[model samples]
Target: MKNSTPKANFESFSFSEDILSAIKAMGFKKPTDIQLKTIPAVLEGKDVLARADTGSGKTAAFVLPLLDNLSNQNVYLRRGRDERFDSSKRAVSN
Candidate 1:
């Protein structure tokens, strides 16, 4: 299998401190391929459809940018927050 590490590290991107801290806490030292590919699109408010085998950090690939987007704006709350996104566990269930 090809290596998945991206050329950029977590801090290389202009992520807020909260996201950076969370990534660090999660022991994520580098961006996986999916993360590298999807994070920018997600942050740019572009719709993304991604597929990868299991254990590919798919959850974080979306969740980190989602959290950043949500934190950067309250649009979701104005539209009536979806309970699914209220918690990570709940998000996966839906």
Candidate 2:
């Protein structure tokens, strides 16, 4: 398999300048697989359900895009176990 870490960069995601600077300052040279798959979806305000190893940079995958979007108030983070939305959707559809 190809090594995603070597070619995966935060720049391709089109993150804000501040976030990009912070990413550099934080020494995150490249994104893990999970981050690569999740960041854009989350940034586009889509509901993302992703799973990865504990140390696979899951936190930053969601947090960075969220922080950049905070100014526009477009953040809504829901966990995988949050089934309340499912129940509500069923009820409304019924």
TM-scores, one per candidate: 0.68, 0.66
Range of the 10 consecutive residues with the lowest summed lDDT in candidate 1: 85-94
* TM-score of candidate 2 to 2 decimals: 0.66
Give the per-residue lDDT of model 2 (tens digit) for 1-94.
2223332689988887878999999999999888888887787888888888999999999999987776445333443554322321231221
lDDT of 1 by residue, 7-58 (tens): 4887866787878998899899898888888887777778889998799988
Clashing pairs in 1: none
Which segments of model 1 are wrong by more than 4 Å?
1-7, 74-94
lDDT of 2: 0.74
Candidate 2 residue pairs in clash (backbone atoms < 3 Å) = none
Segments of candidate 2 deviating more than 4 angstroms:
1-7, 71-94
Worst 10 residues of 2 by lDDT: 85-94
lDDT of each: 0.72, 0.74
Error of 2 at 53 (Å): 0.6
